[model samples]
Target: MADKVVVFDFGGVLIDWNPDYLYRQLITDDTERRRFLTEVCSLDWITQQDGGQPIAKGTAELVARFPEHESLIRAFYERWHEMIRGVLEEGVALVDKLEAAGVPLFGLTNWSDETFPWAWERFSVLRRFRDVVVSGRVKLAKPDPAIYAEMYSRIQQQVPGVAPQDIVFIDDNVKNTRAASALGWHGVHHTSAGATEVQLRELGLAFA
Candidate 1:
């Protein structure tokens, strides 16, 4: 933990971000809500940049994607930002602990730049992160070999002697963790705060 880099997934791991919060704000009709979530928005598109698209574009795309829900797509877009806004206290504490311990932490999230600032404003915890690699900025999402490649390459150039394998990745998506692990980097699939804390402790990353 002295000089190792720790990569974290933002949405589920740190801040209890949920898409339903936004849906409730926009669609009030029970039947319309059911149709929008299950059939239109797929209920969860936070990591997919459903939160990033502007109200108009997001709505248009929604309509295009789900013709039957075209009429309500614009309304869905209006509430998209509000959906992915909450932050988990436990997760933010973990980040603070890891940061205080001198771990070179980075945020690797699949998000678009469009909605990042909006969410950022709502969640101040993002201020703690400096090395953020967003899909919208890099144009490469997680589980893509290239995203991890670029991450390692950039870190190596910025901090000499840093190896890809020296980094530990924690993500909620098993596939994303697997991809990082395949690159010789250690990875943990985080499903809960307790599980992630265990990994941090095991990796000598837990803070006192």
Candidate 2:
């Protein structure tokens, strides 16, 4: 059997990225901040950016739509770095342990092509991954079989004998993990580092 590879999700799994962290600083009023995030910078709108829409263009269109909150809309991508608080220490430790044990590490994330650089620059742990497939770069997001297939294909090309069934995908979202599982890849619905560690152990992957 080929050596099992571990695939990680970027945002909620390894790094701590919450737009509310940035919005809280910009919008002093709690009610207004909630409203602004809901009506203006909704998750659906941001997902479009993750799906390869240029950040500048998206922000400009939002500003045009909500002229009163022009500055706030601009701040969404302007100060995007602030949204990334830091790496989740527990998750990072798991990655470190896995890497130390010689497990092949890969990443599959739904991140904006433009903003991903900021997180990539800030987190050194990301560099540990042998390869990462960014949704924005490919214009394909998770829960979609195509993105997972693309990632599998990339891994197979780089890691000679690797197969879809050899990959163990970890993600915070159940849908993404389920999709990977459906593709014959082992999937871990990551809730916590400890829980994930247990699952890996169960899979017979050793880690310090």
- Highest-scoring model, lDDT: 2
lDDT against the true structure, per candidate, is: 0.73, 0.90
Q: Over the stretch 1-208, how does candidate 1's per-residue lDDT look in tens digits?
A: 4456888888888767665676665678878777767766663453355234444565566678778666556654465556565788888888878888777777788777776677777777776765777776776778889888878876776678987767888898899999999999889899887888887678765576
Residues 23-118 of candidate 2 have per-residue lDDT tens digits of 998898999999989999997788889889988888888888999999889888888888878999999999989999999899999989988887
Where model 1 places Cα greater than 4 Å from the true spot, the runs are 1-3, 24-39, 43-58
lDDT of prediction 2? 0.90
Per-candidate clashes come to 2, 0
Top candidate by TM-score: 2
Please provide TM-scores, in order, for all candidate models, with all chains considered together.
Answer: 0.81, 0.89
Which TM-score value belongs to model 1? 0.81
